[model samples]
Target: MIDEKEHGDVMEIDKELMTKIYDLRRRLHSIPEASMHEMQTKAVLMSFLRENTDLEIVDRGAWFYAVLKSSDDRIGDEERTPIAFRADMDAVCGQDGKPGHYCGHDGHSSILCGAAAWLSRASQNQIINRGVYFIFQPGEEIGAGARLCRDLIIEKNIGEIYGLHNIPGYPRNHVLTIDGTFACASTGLEIHMIGTASHAAYPEAGKNPGPALARLLLEIEELTEEYNRSRGFVRMTLIGMDIGNANYGVAASEGTLRMTVRAEREKVFAGYVDEIKQIAQNTADDGGFTLDIQEIERFPATENHAVNVDKLRKCAADQNIVVTELAEPMRWSEDFGYYLQETKGAFFGVGDGEDHAQLHTAGFEFPDEIIETAVKMFVGLALM
Candidate 1:
């Protein structure tokens, strides 16, 4: 047994079992799959759950979860609400020119698995008073994972849900959470402009939208200032711009503008989108160009329920783990926000270490040292 006095809330972590979880993380690390393409990874997870746990597997096309139902005899008699835990199972393309688990998703999945294994082992003893669901989500990097599983959450009547990401720049093992938004909402916008092409020697014969594109870019920046001043969290970034073909003999007939917009709230992001569309349409008309706009990959801000935040803090304290109340929501976006929209919960963060390599970088690796801490934290919450 790990001493509770030294480690705080972690009273009895199984060392041998934890070693197995670390090995599982290594296996997952070796077979990194991106976004919705997690077939092989899914197979591995399925096999592990089948052979080692008694939980029922609920498989959707791109995502799956293990559900541990409470015994019927103890159902509503117990006042405890059903709790859910989520772990993202997709990897990201890293700087090494290959797909890898640089975001520590491998660790996250293993932590959930470890907690599930313990719950399964302890269920026979009736340690848990209510049902528990362990959700393995895909496409979290592309911001669609939780949305895809939204139905499952609703069907199961999950009373509460929780998730965590490993943060590399904070003190190791510290748990960080916020009361309101935990991350920002963001979406990509693509604007395409089309015009009649003609010979460069007779450029006046063709409608050139170069000037219009320039004006729109400038106007978009100015609009961003207004939104940021009023909303306090809006930001727009011009990612790329393209016009015409490589051939120099013809006046450019087409152009494209790509940008990303983000804000702390969905309302603010919607406001940004509406204004962008208005500006694009006006500019296209003024320049005599036809326009097409496309919205790409979107993630809402991860907002935490106030009660969930308190629960997380109490759980961390029970595990003798330190908890940090974040002053503001992170500017980055997460699809985990979708879960919060469906149920009451909080998506917290666990510190990897102040000196650990940053996420999505080739040099980054998930540290094994924090695995037990993560497992204990989740298990503690379920017990609560």
Candidate 2:
């Protein structure tokens, strides 16, 4: 816990602070390191956090945290569980080698850092009711960092959590409180279709897996469309397709299908997977194809805590920011969904820049305009 005497109503982040944050945001954008490989990112962030604030800092190398203790002396120690704010600090891989900011993780880190500065500043005058935890995690591009941060957050016994991402199409100053479908559920599966090896010229001597694999892909789409229509809610997608043996001649034995199944509920997720597997297996069997399959839960559906959703709505109103209550939940997946699984926390997206392409595209950059707004908003919640 940070020294409480240093906390309170004194927290304020003005224009000059916003400038520093904007510069830092672009600087990180230009570097564009992928997830779990954010060493330079960690260095720059640690330097900034140390230079800008007097908060107690905890560095776990890949994942670091900073805590600002509340100034209230009358508050019981048990109620002092810190409020956590998380930002993933990594870029996506397997891109066009252009070093893109497709997901605005670069922006996410900068905002969280700025929020830390604001909280530190707020700790100066009046006592905040709960401590603040600033979490900067690495390797979120592959969706592994949040699970790693989840343990640390639990170890610290954080009371409530909040997280943010920059979204496409939303305007600046719009604060969203997504009550449901804030994010979607997904699982990654890798399927290998196998066949016997034979010379391409002598294909008749060997069993070919190509026809079987092709049938599987076609059937998957049909089955998914059927499921989507039946439920009228869930959506399934085959995100990847690779088939045939590396060799041209050997009656290509090994093929792989990588896909994600998304749904609003676990039951929907279960139904999607069970049906897909059965259809695929039956298709492969008829085609004389051998199958080696592995499906891993990639991210669970992120449901906002009811009270948190309400509190942040009030928090936005208190900050005088425009609120857009979502009519539909997002279909994208976030590892932060893991944190919400373990604690009462909320993750919301900030505005996407003008003409913004969807995340993971090379043509993306962090917008500097909203930096101060986010910091001030979190500061409002912290000091309340």
Candidate 3:
């Protein structure tokens, strides 16, 4: 447990530090970049670290990490395992169809930076026993960032990792944690059927994939229901479908069906995907069309370790932050699951107030008030 003096020291956020952190968030918000294209965003964060802290920054092209080394001789061997905190640096498109900070990634990155600054200050007067890594990851919006960055955990031999997402519809500054699966596993499945086109007047002269596509939809619905009943929570949503264009003279010959599939467990998720592919293949064969299936934007379930959840709860309690235990796993997915697969860690949420604009909306902007709360929690976790 963190003592009162240590808690007080970590919780003290002066006026200047708060202003700097807020400014950094605003700067990041203004210059939003899409997944795998956060070059400018990376530059700004690296510049801030160089200007504000003395920690070593290692650039890994798409992502980067800042290190805080501890050199206390009194540190015990058990307490020397390194820990890591991650903040995604990618943004999603707003309603205007352009990239923007509609998911509060700016706030997440800024909070990590704030914790880095505080850790730098704390190390000067206090003896930090273990090293900490601050990972500024990219491509989270497309579910590719953590897959690339999880290597750091293996390379550094990190004992635990932590990440947080700002969630609206809850009271601001409330820290949210779950013991098991924190987020669901999800992926995009696209089925394409190709056949020969002929004159619409003689429909039987050509092969039309419309019937096969419609039948495939029904089969998918049945599969979803079966999985939901037998397995845990499972879902499938038809995102889009295009069965040829409106050329009146030509018969519809090719089509594409796109849907997102999600499940609470990885095994169930994979089984559903395999079943979907088989169904599509059978439908294409019966309809006399070539079939192709592709998976995109894949994300594994963000399963939190039970022990790490306890540590996070304890840290929140030490920092005097209210923590809400989540009743169920979030329907959305997070790439941070890649890290937890390799190490022990927890992915949590910070409430952005009940009245705040929902994420991925045009009017959504990250609330600056939660910066201190997140920073204190992260710092306390590091010290723990």
Number of the predicted model whose TM-score against the real structure is largest? 3
Worst 10 residues of 2 by lDDT: 1-10
Ranking of predictions according to lDDT: 3, 1, 2
- Candidate 1, residues 193-217: lDDT per residue as tens digits? 9999999999999997777898999
> How should the candidates be ordered by TM-score, best one leading?
3, 1, 2
lDDT of 3: 0.90
Pick by lDDT: 1 or 2, better one? 1
Q: What is the C-alpha RMSD of each candidate to the true structure, in Å?
A: 2.4, 4.0, 2.2
Clashing pairs in 3: none
lDDT by residue (tens digit), candidate 3, 151-245:
99989888899999999998899999988999999999999999999999998999999889998999999999999999989999999999989
The C-alpha lDDT values of all candidates are: 0.87, 0.75, 0.90
Instruction: Give the runs in model 2 whose Cα sits over 4 Å from its true position.
Output: 1-12, 73-80, 198-205, 229-232, 245-250, 278-289, 295-297
> Model 2 TM-score?
0.86
- List, residue by residue over 1-384, the lDDT tens digit for candidate 2: 122333222334566777888888888877878667788888888888999888888888788888887677634476566788888888876446544667888778888888888667656755466778888988766668888888866787787888887877877668866886588777777777776767888987766666776677788778778767776467756777775646765566566787777887656777777787887788678777787778764777777888888878777776567777777888887878788878888877777654667677666666677776677667666655
**Model 1 ranges off by over 4 Å:** 1-9, 72-79, 95-97
TM-score quality measure for candidate 1: 0.94
